[model samples]
Target: LLDGVRGWLMAGAEPLQRLAAMPTQLWRDVSESTRSRSDLENEIALLDQENLLLKGQMQTFWSLQEENRRLRAALNAAQPLEQDLLLAEAIPVKGDARRQFVLVNRGSRDGVFVGQAALVAEGLLGQVLHVGPRTAEILLLSDDTHAVPVRIARTGQRAIAQGTGNGERMEILYLPSNADVKEGDVLVTSGLGGIFPPGYPVATVSAIAEAAGGDFARVSARPLAPVDDVREVLLLWMRDTVSADLPKTDHAP
Candidate 1:
């Protein structure tokens, strides 16, 4: 062991002695080693940071997938109700010149047809204008051509609620000047037209104006149901009962 140690010292020290490296060279090597180690540590930290970011993205992906699955399940559960009605989705909005209508994801294939009543949970939105194999257009209650015979929910004072394209409101026309309707009066479908059902909340009197020149009181009402927020609506397919099937269209006797 002693001989081996002496031989190693002689051989090892000879190269250093011949090279004549200064103290500064040794310090430089040590500093370079420290710097290389620091660079390696920095690279490792960067890789760790990249890995954390990737993990966070993966977590977000999974969360969105879970949320989508939950929504799909809820939509499926809304099917198969025992009521004489069909559920349909309003999936398209056509805002074009010469054609202003909405298309629904229901049609003859889904047992929907023309003249069927389309109603939201709040109230009526429209009726089926044209139905195809898997889709239909709904003439929204706000359309200028749409008309609904409505009555005062309080006084039963009958009047025709006409769509004026004036958003969120229905124009109750042909009311008598001395009518008892006031602001905030509730208006509902009388089912007198044989189109809409009775007791469905349609709109509320937002403004009551009595123009002196106009013989009729202009009673404008805001729709209780949201026209733009219509997502899912129910179609009334049940045939009316004996009393409702009478020849007299007016429900108010």
Candidate 2:
């Protein structure tokens, strides 16, 4: 009887020990699985972040490509003389945030001179005011002292477009109250003043306000050139015929 009882106790103890060890083994397996899952999640997050950055870079590249294409088309349409065309890089002017002035990489050594016309992809920027051996300053159309002789594309009515010292717009002075000009009318260089080439785009009329008792209409226009954001310009050397036709004055202003 004693032997049988000892055998029974031994058997029961073996089963109890196995049960305790089973729980430990289960805990170890669960911990290992959790760690593997955590590592996978971290890797996925890193890949997503990299993808977003790549998308942004692609967008920037396409935008620059489109801008260059437009610039090329405008250059071809202008049909500037090969000998007269001087491609110039823009140099920002300090303290002229109003887009009143800009500098270029061309100068007297590059065949650029004072009073030469500076054009961008869209339209005229200004005349070269000062020249250096390797740099030149441009007087933007938004300068208060600057003026361009412009005519209405529809009616051939001539008017003086003057800068308002603001980057976004200019003004036309001394228009008769009953003038044929209207909003959305296109303005171009009239060839009356030799500073700008004739038939070049300048500005578009934006608003017209006439006082009840005033004799002249108050006219405002938006400049065609992007003076605040232009990066390149064309320095056109006027043909001999055009240069001789110019009057003694450099510009109207």
Candidate 3:
């Protein structure tokens, strides 16, 4: 019995000795894994911060580029030296489903008034609808309610070009069914109404069709003017008393 007892005691001590040696190796592996995880987390955070910084920088660069272009164009157009021509920067776009509108920096104090004509980089925009002290509202050529006197540039046939409340669509009322006008014909201001100048382009004929039993051809117009992409406009100075009288409002106060 004594011999059997001693053998069992030796067996128990051997296992305890092995267990004491194992903890150091296990702790070393755990520390290494923890360090690896910490490094990966830090790298991910750095990348996220870098991406945000780059996006902000890109936005600033593009904004500066657009502003530079606008100022350069304004400088060139301002060189004509008319005593009364006022150049205004377009500030905001007021989008309506049936009409297009823009707000310019000039207003009544700057001689901008309702019914005063406004032109963009390409061509005619529309007449001034509402004027304020520091800002003015411009009605675009695409409004359903606004109409302009126009002529077929190729044939000199006078007609009224009216807006259709959509992109590049308008109407001409008095063109005869057999008029020399056809698709792809260009239309310009006729200067008959005395609102627009004689040489500025207005639109192009996109389609021509006869109404049911009507004497006139229903002509569709696509405006040559840049109505949607305007960032600045030129306000013409009127020396003629007639143009001064054309403004809808006389009292600025």
Candidate 4:
């Protein structure tokens, strides 16, 4: 009878042992599943990073293409001018926003002279302000102190468009209140001051507000050549050509 009771007790102890092991076995399974999920998450993160890098590369490629296209157009436009041209890359100067000045790679050695007009395919950029041995400073048309002689393309009415130190806008100074000007009228260089060539696009009228009890109209326009994004420019050598043609005279003591 005692032996039978001992066998029964042993059978009961076997089930209790299995019950204790159940929690440990379940924990191991959960750990394995968690590790698999973590691996999948890491792979997804790496793929996303790769996709972003590809998108950035594509954007850069398109930007380069557009820059090349503009450069080609600028070269073509310069061919029609009788004067020689020097191609130059625009360099951003520190404090350019306030001074509205840019640096170019051409200088006196390249026949670039002060006051020579800088242009792009779309319109005139500015005049050379300062010259260095290997570089030059350009006074952008958006400089507050700079002014360009411009005319209404439609009616040939002349006016002086002055820079407001703003890259995207210019103001016509002393325009008569009754002037035959309207919004969207194209303004071009009048070739009056002999600075910029005639018929080069400058700006277009954007707004005109009449001065209260005054004869002048407060006119504002947008510049055709905003140099902020342009990569290259044409330096007109017309002034150099003219200087070359002038007869040099010896000075007497």
Q: Give candidate 2's error at residue 215 in angstroms.
A: 3.6
Per-residue lDDT tens digits of candidate 2, residues 12-120?
8998988989889888888888989999989999989999998899899898796567557556544354324557788766766554778888776676678888888
lDDT of 1 by residue, 41-96 (tens): 99999999999999999999997686456344333423332224556667856574
TM-score of each: 0.60, 0.64, 0.61, 0.65
lDDT of 4 by residue, 1-253 (tens): 9999999998999999889998998898999889999999999999999999999998999987876776566545432455645568887656644688888887766666788889887888999999986788988898899999989999988899999988888999878888899999999888888888788888999998877888888899999986567567777756456466322322100
Query: 1-253, model 3: which lDDT tens digit per residue?
Result: 9989999998989989879977986888888888999998999999999999999998999987875665455334322332234567889664777667888888866667688878765556788999998799988888988899988989999889998777578888688877898899988778787767665677889997766677788899898767777777877655564356334444221
lDDT (C-alpha) at residue 119 in model 2: 82
- Per-model clash counts, in order, read 0, 0, 0, 0
After superposition, candidate 3 runs with Cα above 4 Å error:
1-84, 241-253
Which ten-residue region of model 3 has the weakest summed lDDT? Answer: 74-83
lDDT of 4 at 104: 84
Tell me the lDDT of model 1 at 16.
Answer: 89
lDDT of 4: 0.80
Order of all candidates by lDDT, from best down to worst?
4, 2, 3, 1
> Would you list the C-alpha lDDT of every candidate in the order shown?
0.73, 0.78, 0.75, 0.80
